[model samples]
Target: MKAVEYRLPKEFDKSFIVFTERGTYFPCPWHYHPEYEFVLVNRSTGRRMVGDHIGYFDEGDLVFMGPALPHVWVNDAAYVQGQAKEEASAVVVHFVEDFLGKNFLSLPELEPLKKVLDLSKRGLVITGKTKKEINRRINGMIGESGLRRLSSLFTIFDILTHSSEYQPLASPSYMQHTQGYYSDRFSKITDYILRNFQHEISLNEVASEANMATTTFCNFFKEHYRMTFVEYLNTIRIGHVCKLLADSDENVVNIAYECGFNNLANFNRQFKRLKGMSPSEYRKTLELQSA
Candidate 1:
């Protein structure tokens, strides 16, 4: 997506920011920034998009992203409609590579940290005990100041570099594509898909939106997304299905139709291809985890 670039609220006295974001909902649009970000979703449930990857996010969701990786956490319908019982909230930390000093990470002793930061180019979602410790330290940093706050950040990095409890969010193909500048045309196309994916979205329809012939648009999309339009559309539909499966008691057949799948078998096939589990199994897994 064509993400709007954002400037963090500057504080000349501080090298980094550690704060709690609390509100009825997270209001940031799909956006990017030059600073690396560490986010701990303390209270919320939503769809999170990082680069070309789409996944559901909930309370205790922790992700760290490299600079300029486009992302947004879109609250579920209940939060957007102000019907959610608990307000959205998160603990977020943002810092540039040189927040300590340009030469600091170049040090041999910091090689592991540098490696982790490179891996973060695709965004990393923390899990297991590592996530628990990082969340606690991030919350603690809210009250720290001066060198102490900075120290806490390094400590968090140390944990990340040494731990295996994380997974990359964006695909390598997507990351390779992001290295190039984004086109406004692709932005418009993705926006249209996101808005209208609940209905049948024809290749010709999106090609028209991009002001290109179907053949031309097909090549353009494949060049940027490394996938055919049908694949990308199915990806989006399946992502929404994941959120619905987790958040509602809706029947699988009905949910598939609502997400624009006309055939139950196709929905099941696509869901398993993308998510590695059947719809019922996916929901059951979440239930087991929560319990």
Candidate 2:
């Protein structure tokens, strides 16, 4: 999908931005910006889209995204409907690569940090111990200013440079295609799917949304997503099912149907295919972790 370019609020005297976002629900749509983003979700459960990658996110979710990498975190429907127990909140930091100076990262001592910045182009899923440590640093940046704030930002880079508990989202193919294609029609299609994935969606419906013939849309989708439209939609649905399994007491069959799966067997197969475990087993793992 084509990402809308969003301008970060300017703070001319400050080199970067660090703030806590709290609200009934996050208001940003699918968008991207020039500044790299460091996000730690302090309280929320929802779906996250970074480039073409679709996944579920819960409290403690952390990600690093480079400049112009499309992304958004949409709070689950409960949050939007004012039914969630906790308000959605996060610690967000934004800064450009040359925020210090164009020559700053070029320095010999900063080369490792510069390399990590480059890797952020595909977006980084900061996980394991690194995720916790980075969250601590990001939380510390709140209400901090002057040299202390800058130090916290640099400390995050230092930790990321030394940590391997991170994975790249957005496939390499999708990242390559993003350099050339930013279609509004694609954006319309993705926005439509995200809003309606809880119900059945058809090939013709999405193709028509793109204003393309089914054959043409298939080729176009493959070129951009490197997967069939159905593959992408199933991935999104399964991601939502994972969230429900972990966060609620919904029955597996009901969760599958609510997530747009009409067939229980197919839902089980797709869930296992995408998550490497059956839905019940996945929930068991989550319970064990909590216990």
lDDT of 1 by residue, 158-202 (tens): 898889899878644344333223357766887788788889888
Q: Any runs in candidate 2 off by more than 4 Å, and if so which?
A: 177-291
Q: Extract clashing residue pairs from model 2.
A: none
- lDDT, each prediction: 0.82, 0.80
Error of model 1, residue 52, in angstroms: 1.3
Q: Write the residue-wise lDDT of candidate 2 on 1-291 in tens digits.
A: 235799878577789988788999888776889899988899999878776566789999999998887788888889989999989999889998788888987799887776677668879999999999899889988878889988888888889989989987864433432222234776677677777888889899999888899999999999987789998888778766766765588899889999899988888888777766788887775554333
Clashing pairs in 1: none
